[model samples]
Target: MKKILSVTGALLLSASSYAADLTIYTYDSFVSEWGPGPKLEKAFEAQCQCDMVFIAVDDGVSILNRLRIEKTKTKADVILGIDDALIEVARGEELVQPHGVTVTGLKQELNWSDADFIPFDYGYFSFIYDSQKITTPPTSLKALIESDAPVIYQDPRTSTPGQGLMLWVKRVYGDQSDTAWEQLAKHTVTVTKGWWEAYSMFLKGDADYVLSYNTSPAYHVVTENKTQYKAAEFSEGHVAQIEVAAITQASKNTPLAKAFLTFLISPEAQTIIATNNWMLPVVDGLTLPAVFAELITPKRIGFTPKEVAEQRQFWVREWRSAATR
Candidate 1:
């Protein structure tokens, strides 16, 4: 009887080990303790009855590159944290499978028809500054370029916010993007590899301003009860960044992955993502805290995926040349 009991325990252990484990590749910030990752993990695990593992990379662009390197052998069942700026590149690589979920109740401002990726949360790219430090914040990109205020930004090669700023400049200046970059380069104290590094530097008083999202101020307002930080709205209009998640083509657990994707836009998940990630929730009816409601929502500048795909390389090259000069 003792031998039988031991064998039974071993069999149970083996069965548990063989159970499906869904792996998701996401940005490092999303998985941090204060981010929505922990809460989402707990909520999903309770419903799915399966193991959920999150593998974090540097940023959204890095997530795509890593998936490309692994190709079909990628262990990522789902890729999260990709914004609209990089979605064209991801679709070009054909790294994702169609989500096939009938999405609805998205905010009227966002119109998403893509069947492959589901919108999770979104925010408008803006420059953030401490009101006390910057008594007169630049109201336009031209004003910012002309000012002597020190600024720090991320590199577009590795960061989504960096790419958004690049596109923002291009959208504002058009053929004179090079000129804009040259002026911006003058005030730029330094350019880091990702958003967190640049924002950290700004918070540490390394620079007068940092490139970040309009919703970023909400985090400080709600979490720390500090209201000095504010997003500067430029006359050129802010770039809208719609973040998305999708199941990878290489996923072994497609059903579970699909279920997770569906859950992402659900009211429960959106509430956690909006409050913790400090972004606007895609779905409606989720009650936002007072701080979020007080955040600025700027007029958006629209760009198509085709236009972004066609011009991204040229814009980056132009930006690099101007910045270096």
Candidate 2:
């Protein structure tokens, strides 16, 4: 009986070791020509001698919904690129497990909580304004809402940055956010389903400013090689968000998945994220792309998940009604 038990344990360990083909579900950019998907696939295969398959979906919500639909029969071993705002959905679904591996040199600010998730990089949401259209950008959220200048924003219920904007208002106005939303309602020219739509409209000269990240201009300045747009400085600071990765509970190769999470924090991956992914790396000492290293200034804000969570649904509902009118 003891020999049978020993054989059973060994077989279990062997099965786990053999199940190293990793499937990661993430957004489109992670697999795009400029993103880290190709590099990660190459590096992980080189290091682990296992297959790394990335299933690219439209956005974070679709990825989470796919996991929920799959449930116990989940297809991916890891889930990456979920920002702080959507981290709750991943957590609530019980999709993530506590990663035992430690990531080296993650920024102290990123240690926001000791949750199951690990933050890989972060950025702040601020209006990306066309400098040619508006010589003087609005310096505060109140001014943006009140300005006669045509403004475009993504719908808070559907868009990540739009959700960030809602959180920004809740953080600044607190209990009076309902009134603030009412004020913003009057100025909005259109509410898009996603950032791509809103930003495209702004770029085509339809609006003066489009709600987006401080780091967004980094992409234009560095990649596109022109500074046609810039992030507006707000007196109330900006809504900062951290993107995180996690080992999925559905992973058959838990150990390998954990190792990949560690790899994502490596200098190699963080550098790719900063230069190609258009996000600030979580690693403290890594230098950013030359243009970003010069153009972007980090904002100090009191934004927190707790405050944002409390008011997110309320803000989304209010915006929906106001937007329709």
* Candidate whose TM-score is highest: 1
Error of 1 at 60 (Å): 0.8
Query: How well does candidate 2 score on lDDT at residue 213?
Result: 76
Listed in order, each prediction's TM-score against the native is 0.93, 0.85
The local lDDT score (0 to 100) that residue 97 gets in candidate 1 is 88
Kindly list the per-residue Cα lDDT of model 1 for residues 1-325, writing each as its tens digit.
2332343334333334435998999988899999999999998776666898999987887898899889899999999998888787888888998976667677877878888998999999999999988888989977887778899988887888988999888888889888888888888999988788888889999999899999999999899999999999888788999999998989897777777877787777889999899999997777898887788878899588788888888888998999989
Mind giving the per-residue lDDT tens digits that candidate 2 earns over 1-325? 2332343334334434554688898877678887778877886576666788899765555566678789779888888866787766667678888877544456777665544777777888878887876787878888887667778887665566777777777778877777777777677788776666787788888887888778888888888888877988888777787877887888888777776776677766677778777878887667776766655565667545654556556667865665565
Model 1, residue 222: displacement in angstroms?
0.7
* lDDT of model 2 at position 256: 75
Please count the clashing residue pairs in each candidate, in the order shown: 0, 0
